[model samples]
Target: MSSEATIRRGVRNSRYAAIPNHVFEDSRLSMEARWLLSYLLSKPDNWTVVIGDIIKKGNCGRDKARGMIAELVKFGYAEREQQRADGKFGSSVLVIFDEPRDSHAAEIVGETSGVAFLPQTDLPATVSPSPVPPSPVKSAHSNNLDSANTDCQKEREGARAGSEESDTSVVEDRKRIERDFKAWYRTWPTSLNDSEQAARDAWAALTPEERAACIERTPTFISAVKAIKGKFTFSSVYLKGKAWEKLDDPKSEVALPTVHNPFSRAWMAGMLAILLRPPLTANMPAPTKFQLGQIAQGGDEADAVRIDRLQKYGWPRVNTMHQRAFDRQGVTVPPPLVAISEGFEQVHRDADLAKRWKRAFERRGWPWLPNTGHEWFFFPAGEPDEALAKFSEATARERGDDDAA
Candidate 1:
């Protein structure tokens, strides 16, 4: 029979539902299957075509086109009508089943005969008997099929087991390396800070693998240590070099200059205190005569002197003079510096009388006569009382304001 005739006969006897919407929802379907379905549905009969034509028109590989055809059949959307050519040279034709077979057959028959065949609603739901129990020989064949399925399952399980074991080993190795590296980094700094002999003692304790891992994971170790300590202050050249190397970008060609034996903030503070002397007797020695003159000026020049001293001594005081000068010409010092100086002046003023009294007593003899009853009061008696009272009043006011806030 012709491909179309065979399809029509099959449709007449076939009892199957229309293709479900969920089947085509899969994203894996190739572009060919989508086009093929739409093209076949447009025609009334299942058209036969060479598989090669499908591949060419679909713009896909032959294997891909074949896979798409197989998918459509598996999903109940299409069927293949295969034919064996009898000593013919021509390619075998493929008939695609487009619409639900029963529906198409009913429509075709109704159109040809001019009679509509209404589906029977009152017909009993018939359930066909399960296929006859397998014969003894067929039963043996079924057992062989089961054994084959079991073997295939076992092979798949073994492959999965091998993969899982490798993955577990990798995970354990990673965890162990991480633990060892953390412990090593914590102890590594001690060795770097120690004497040559002490460092050798510590280095000898570490394993070769641990040393390699430490080098590899230095950046991570530095970051973790910084987080735990809140800040990292390198005190020596060796520590600085190690830190820089750990944080350095490997892709860059230029090498950074190394810093050695970093200066302390305390050292800077002492140097600054010496450079910017107040009008006090127990003052630190000035670094230069110009700095001394600047300190004597007691305004912007005084601040400049202080800042210069601080910076020279390695303290990082923010340079506000440039910004201040930009905003308002002739304004040499910033407002923050002015505020700080004002606070200092207030403190000095509060202690002025006590300071004067103490100095006076030290230089000159006691003011009270030796025979007078006041000689028993050895320390400065009434001089600091007013200043102390004012200080207490100011402190109370400040506390009250803070509490209100």
Candidate 2:
């Protein structure tokens, strides 16, 4: 047989109420009655006990509250005396004691004690009450009780202050968690739809260190999922499983698939033309013709570098560039560049590429080589009609296509 042991602790300078152990030890009293008795005893001697107060404190219905009080009264832990005012019967006032009183002794003591009872004027007409007057004399024991009550009050005040601080900390931490969750969610390739709330809750449950790990490892996970052609799971399930924890660091992952760019110079120029559209570029300073060419060339080179990195080191390598862009300039990787690096199939459907390029050039006020019949274009709002003549002839001579030109 297993033996059980009991342990007891005594309070030192800490705030606490003193109660007779017999109250708890008594088998005759109900647990509710014992608790109610302890609560009453913890109050100051002159404190009034009301049924409403008891109901609120115990979170119980009126019937249960009254029943507990009746139990205490039956056990001789409390007494009630009906009042008389102007020859009319009034509501009874109650007195609770830390120890039970004998019925015969209670009667004699009530007659001689002259205990004061406060009236409840604001209460229902059933109990018109008034305040109790303070006693003119204080004994040494009364002074000691006052000191203990003072300590209890101080302890309560300190506890309340600490609780407020703790609540503030919790609020601040939740705000930070929500902000980080939004950042992480933005990087997810697919929509979560209905699972968003559950995902947020799961993310909130993670420790700060775990959250950081999850955020840092997400790109690698995305790469793996894409590599295997696996379907993405709900964000809630991902977070709950701590899926990022199982993946190796992005730097060590290998066998990345090669990504290829499919945009020709003409197609790229058209895309760049859309990027530099008036409505979008209105906030940007107008670039010179030379500067526009440089911008297009530079943009193309950057896209090529990103594609190369994606093929060599996978998504994490390219995602690091996105992170750096945001961290350094508070911006995201440009959409066109992202589209080009993720898939070449999108660029393969190029049958309408030249038509779209023509439309873009027309909208942006650029014109094609006049004699060459709109084969090549010049940029930056307005250019001479023969702007590409010299370059086209030089290209024709190089290809031995002078007669074709």
Q: Which candidate has the highest TM-score of all?
A: 2
- Which candidate leads the pack in lDDT? 2
Candidate 1 lDDT over residue span 29-129, tens digit each: 45567566554444322222334334545767657767876765654555544443475432222334433334554354345443234454656335342
Give candidate 1 regions above 4 Å deviation: 1-31, 44-46, 84-93, 99-405
Candidate 2 lDDT over residue span 105-211, tens digit each: 44543444443122334442232222542222222111111221222212322222236664455456557767989999878776446467677766754556778
lDDT of candidates 1 onward, in order: 0.35, 0.46
Clash count for candidate 2 is 4
The C-alpha stretches of model 2 lying farther than 4 A from their native spots are 1-16, 103-405
Q: In model 2, state the lDDT of residue 31.
A: 89
Local error of candidate 2 at residue 179 (angstroms):
39
TM-score each candidate: 0.19, 0.25
- Backbone clash tally (model 1): 0
Error of 2 at 143 (Å): 30
